[model samples]
Target chain A: MSSATTTAPESGHGHHHHNPEDRLALLKQIWMFSTDHKVIGIQFLVTTLLMLMVGGALALGVRWQLAFPWENMPFFGLLFPTEGGQISPEAYTMLFTMHATVMIFLVIIPVLAGAFGNFLIPLMIGADDMAFPILNALSYWFMWPAIFCFGASFFFGGGPGNGWTSYPVLSAVPEAAPGSGFAQFFWLMGVTLVGVSSMMGSVNYMTTIINMRAPGMTLFRMPLTIWGMFITAILQAFALPVLTAAGFMLVSDRMLGTCFFIPSGMVINNADPTVGGGQPLLWQHLFWFYSHPAVYIMLLPAMGMVSDMLACCCRKPIFGYKPMVYSMAAIAGLGFIVWGHHMFTSGMNPALGMTFMISTVMIALPSAVKVFNWIGTIWGGRPEFNTVFLNCVAFVSMFIVGGLSGIFMAAVPVDIYIHDTYFIVAHFHYVLFGATLFGVFGAVHFWFPKMFGRRMDETLGKWHFFLTFIGFNGTFFPMHLLGVAGMPRRYADPYLHPYLENLLPMNQFMTICACLMGFAQFILLFNFAYSLFKGQKAGMNPWLANGLEWVAPSPPGHGNFAAVPTVYRGPYEYSAPERDDDHWLQTEPPKSSPVPEPPKPEPTPDSAPVGEDTGSSS
Target chain B: MSEISHDTGSHAHDDTHHYVNYFLIFIALCICTGISVLFDVFKGGIPKSALVFGVMAVAVAKALFVMTYFMHLKFEGAWKFIILAPTAILAVGLMIALAPDMAMHYYTNDAPQVKWVGGEHAEEVAETEHSEHSEHQHEHGGH
Candidate 1:
């Protein structure tokens, strides 16, 4: 292995001497079906970005229906000429359902775990590549089949309209709704395959992080990004199997004459009575069992990434690094038990609801710890206030709003009122779109230099951030008021009710803000595209960060590094007093003496000042 | 300095192969399965709760035998517990959480018992097949 490291310098430059034909072939090989982790990460990035547009368009359709109920809509209204450009009630159901489906399965999960997780994990941990490179590539390819299933659902009679939860009886009985026939089947298949892809990726991540670390890159010394990815992998591996099982059972009930979620003597859509005695609530149990932990799976990686970004932009060590790790683990663990909170309105036992409520509230302890620690990290440092810093701050601010609203839902009595209201919708958007997506936006800017050897236009990036933040708040904040006003979610036309008719103006305001938010993303897409070719060339270590990845070349070649980097201290060693430079690199040997032993239990903040580890070692 | 070169290979390098009687474990698993089946077969004689408990216990024993011997978790490091414990806890917790609604049948009477009538309108269907039991009305009172 050391011999390969020695010969890497010559082989790395060999690509430069290739003829035009060979270069084209090499480009085709790398971009098309390459198993390089970096290429796979970019593949996920591009694919999920496209899906984000699709999901956003679906959401805009949903908003249009709400703001101007039964009115002829633009763009989507063209598809429904029979209704004079107005979306049908059934189409409205499919709109919100597919919007959530694409955002969760296709966009957020893939972009975080599949995109950033793949690109950062091996580099940050000083590994050459993922533990299973072929399996990693397979994970990205498997997403297409899932995407195909989801896309195919739309053609097969309007798509699954039972919402992303797909609670059965409606989902199981094919004749139950306009979209329940083959569209629901395809949706189930899509979910199952997405679970399969996620399972594969999580297994690969766990193995790579556990076994493939370079020397001195111990579990504790690894970056919080790695810790978040590692814990998220564990959550995915444990929770995804249940979703896959539930998906299969639903498919069987619809297609294979099984009754896992169907009960007897129930006639839906004028069909013959169902004969099976299987319970509908059973699906809720199995689904939420996986889905509850999945909320953290969507979140913890961003939490991890935001911690790293906040420390970097703030020029401070993350406040209580070990505590942050423990809290993340605690969140994942508690995530499993608190799933019953989602089932409070399903006529679950009061005793069970009480148990779930307690666990759900207890989960808030870890979340609040993370929020406070983030604020603490930003407290005393001379902050950079760049695009990265601004987005990280937004993530913290939005997470507080999301986390506080979640507490209300955790209470049985409160949840009973707001269970199916727009309030629930607002709470999750703040978490998923507000917190997680903002973290992703920050990360994309922070790591764009490393991903493409170029920096995104900071001015453009900040504009994207501000528009998104303002648009996001304007769009979702009013939903809390709407929910309190007794506006139910998934309603095609709430204006039909006299009590809710007064809220039409508020809904219209929110829809306009949503359109602004949706269009502001084009600035990001343009920045990404324009910057890829024309943006300023960012030398390695552009951010002047302390992590091991800063030691690698910008847009690192095939194996990610010329040689495996050996870590000395933790990743967040910014602004140490002993060093003249503000940043330190993990691979830098101590200037005066050999690297000291890792700190003992009572770890001091300024204990290890290895060297003036400033320039790019690559 | 700890000079660790990249070694993308198998981490498990236990050369010492422990002797395990796989045939015996297999036979034990089969016997456990047979016992559970027998309990189910004679369920009429046994009390319903005892039959269920006895069969589930037997099934658990079989699973343990498979995981310990066939899956070689017994020979694995203590990390096996770290990995398996949460899953075990969650599985049990899920059962505990599900038991009240699924097993207890607490609100079975209030559960909607819909009948199919050959009609398009819901009002006509409701009038013909009227079994709209209120959720609070407990048809079966004190246990």
Candidate 2:
């Protein structure tokens, strides 16, 4: 195929030729309530990045309390000077609770699906825009209400202290804790709105991916990123309604004198005993039902993007593409059944726990398949050691650690011993912070030129990655040992207990490392801001990726392509013997392809079509 | 590059519209609801398991009617099975998974049941509280 077909339209309307004032005005117009998928994706990216800082700050507070109990914290303690610059235990509870809340809801999930998914889906699939552009914008707009609700909760009764899971009785009864009343109500509202936002996005993605592929962009021929997104959309569509329903139920239980999750004869805070026959365990079942799959919802998109980046950086055809797709589907399928693993310690029956354990362990099979495929893709290839590649490698390495730790938690006996300990905390941080965030960082750099017309500074990016990698390991790895030493999570001060007193120094060390990790993010933020203005100009296809997105102009115009490109082969056709170039674009047609066929006239009653039925299948 | 001609005509507007009697389906759903309500109202005479099963069966029938007719799943292509089957399976699977703990209440004590203290016991409690309040008032008056 002629490259000129894709590049010709961009020549006349180059963004760089415009005056700075004109470009600024154009950007301002696009940034404000625009229905363009690219604008909405950037909107999500910037918003989530801000929320990531907020969540990170909350995490630092938790670390400070763990490291130096009851002593004056640097910035946070000043907010509570009435208690002699020390954070109250209730404040400590809120810190960790909101930390997880902001990280999972505002940062990881949105950054993956809302930011990268929205931006990449249309571009990668060779579509001009989403199937429903208005609905896509609405999805981005919906996130603000959730952010507002979560932010407002901090002012009202010190925010929801009952953890991110929001298990009811604590979440249901308003009088249960200081934050359980209006603050918890706000938290639930926030969660409900996030669900609404996600539901809208999932529907939009599903429709766009299924129906809006360009001519010849068949499902099998699409990149694994699209497949990952497609499967994640399906998972969200099926799973989110349950969580939405459960969230509303929890809300009702809190406000409307309903008791869906609150059992009868429960007294909280010397208050009157509750008088309803609702089961607390039911909440666990429902919450984990969505949240277990939610774990994959958080990771799978990153897994897909990492696969693409890995192949490009390694300059190899992805090893076992079909297997990768099948494995993602397998992971999503098994994710549902293994939710029971979360509820094993909640007094669920042993038989049910056993089934969950087995299912959870079985998820490892598909995950291992993906890991092997990624490794195979890396082997026997000339590799580029760019920032994107480093982060991709980190994602794989960290995910292995996270997935291995998860197996121990999947077993009934082992999990019972370490349930709610720092081990569970270590395991998920490895996955969420270690794997998903690193993958997202790689994706941001990889696609920065496509989003804008510039590349992020690689030198600063390397510094940021190394500091983060070292600091992240230093912070979280010892938490495994802390878990083994019986350091239960969500404690205000574990050192208060004699058995855990000696662990204080280790906690302090982790706290210092956490600070380092937290500060390293500033370098990233600075790099991003500086690069937006001063970074080197990148032409289209900076990474020389094989995906359809690479064919589009850097910072693609309103309708992404000058002409819609047709796919002739699968996305990962690197190093084909038929071509001298290492990478072959999906749209590139074969040199000697046959072109004799012409359209036949439609058959009528006088000239009936032979050998085929023309009737609709339905 | 030779542009491939897209067969957009294949997805042209179908003039043939399948009309379903939504009113009749709504009536069917109402009848199913009435049956469930009747079963629930007369649950005292029926065995608990039978009553639960009968009411649930009626509910399922109502859902089927709505899905097949009102939602036009019956007129949809075989892709409806692809979409609905996994959802149906997961829903049933979740229910089954939840049963061991939620339904059976295994190992743990049965869900605590709060008894309604009505008819006589409520009056006694009220009378005792009233006397206690009057005596306390009298003591306060004396003081």
Candidate 3:
């Protein structure tokens, strides 16, 4: 702590008040199309947070309906219809469908991979900017049209009623669902645009990571966070195109009179259908082909960030760093082969089911290895019970439940009962909400000072974490029981079933917990907003963390580094026996050697107006 | 050959490449398409499977030519093959996995009934297995 305090002065070239012209131009550049990765990252953060709020509101509505199945005479319920605020079946279908879509596509993916990945990669790798700045901006810009399409779908007639998977036959025909008309078209187009945006971001991420690493920052020298993001980017690059193609085929089915996914059904509403000779299962196959990898796409970045934060907070090197990296790689590689697991009950061949079950079970091995390594990393180390550390620990514990529960679904026998049940809902929420969402909370807290140049209130942050952890468990854990009791998911009314009658009290309880959880998130939102300006000023290396990102000033300038930094060691050099401080800087000179001053830049024929690289001799 | 240098600070690399050979490959692809069409035209006497195999071979050849030359994969280094090989293998593997489903129609016996529009005619669910089992066959024959 003393060493960090002593060194803080050197790094405190904090933000100074700029002239009016400079301030106006900076504001304009930030709000408009700025190519800086940091600004782009902020844009993604703000946009995705807003999307999260919208998705959360939809989830509340869903819970509201479930809590009081038919008694929906409320302020918000009036938006659906005049029938005493009771949610119509059509609107209820739209509620959960749009909720899943917005959360997965708009919030999680963008906030985790798009925002943090963009912001941290250049800083972590000691690069100035992404390989293609214009392309990066285009990736962010592409999301807008996708968002607009999603909003426009509601007004076109209704929003898409099909689940996020949007399986065909039901999703294909306008006659099948109320919103399956022009609205479905808008939904398809929105997804396609998002796919394109993700593709652009992935390409930029891959190229920049591969090509723009600073001198001495070899592949192995990279932080686990970068590796996580890198592998996630790779998954996105390959997997998203499959989804795009699926979306295209679906669009053709809807608009171009094609029967790619529509099966040869003789009757709909007791009337002979015009479309025929397509396979509905084809949609499931293609959708899951990308979607299964998409699960890793959401999880990997969080895993990576958690690894880094754990290493930092524990004041130790991450245990089995190589194994951790390999496990993620293995996870990504096995992700492709396990897509068939999602299709086991879709009238797929039993032999194919056996093959898929084996692969799906095998994929869990690497994830388990990662969990073991995280525990090993934290085993003997002194830990700071900061909000970041608390959330990260929650991620590990909750992810174990998420991972172990997946085994039940991966086994064909068990999945038969739990396929569309609340059990599956609980399984995914543990991973998505418990693991990834918690990771998001942790990473934001850990990096907020570097991001906004202010510290978030520690007391407030801890309260947010505890309430969220308790509320999340309270809401979702009972779902496993409900599922075991044979409660089916996506049904507007479970009261219709005699078997589901007793589950009403439990549902009511869960809904109350869910509302509490949703409200608890506002503490985070408030903490984030208030701390951005009014919180205590954060100096560089406030966490005393060992990474190149901490070497840069808090909220780094346009090009990030004052001079191109040469990395001398791996990111986690914490608690080295010889070092007096808990962490060692990657760029620091050895004790035997005096600090070398920057060499004068020699004029070159191809010299641009940009500052010359200052070579620091180690 | 256009040899443009992409000066991206510390990671400046040359992205410029020759284009004249790409045009030649395009011409070759055109010839291959013609050959494929010729196979289809003269296949009246040939076995249908053999004709399909011949056409597929020509398409593969044309695709390789385009990927290697027109797509500039030849000059793009080893990573191009590394990235592309797995994608090709997985795609083909998925197709193979789907072969049984493509070749067989399972709903000839008892099939899931389509939900009717407007929620009318929805109360046969009690004996749905027995009744729809016999009725679906008629629709299968009609298709």
Which model scores highest in DockQ? 2
- Candidate 1's displacement at residue A552, Å, is 0.8
lDDT tens readout by residue for model 2, A84-106? 89999999999999999999999
RMSD of each: 9.1, 7.2, 8.8
lDDT of 3 by residue, B5-116 (tens): 5345313323355445566777888899998889878978889999899899999998888777767676565555456666676668768767665555454422234443
Docking class of 2: acceptable
Candidate 2 regions with alpha-carbon error over 4 angstroms = A1-31, A594-618, B1-59, B108-143
Which residue ranges in model 3 land beyond 4 Å of their true spot? A1-30, A270-272, A589-618, B1-34, B45-48, B69-76, B105-143
Which digits, one per residue and each the tens of the lDDT, describe model 1 over residues A211-295?
A: 6888777678989999889888888888889888888889999999998888887878787888777888999999998898889
Better of 2 and 3 by TM-score: 2
**DockQ of candidate 2 relative to the true structure:** 0.24
Best candidate, TM-score: 2
Choose 1 or 3, whichever is better by lDDT: 1
Least well predicted 10-residue stretch by lDDT in candidate 1 chain A: A609-618
What local lDDT does model 2 show for residue A294?
A: 89
Q: What is the TM-score of chain A alone in each candidate?
A: 0.93, 0.94, 0.93
For residues A240-350, write the lDDT of model 3, one tens digit per residue.
Answer: 888899899999988888988776654655656655567788888889988989999999999999999999999999999988988888888888778888877788877
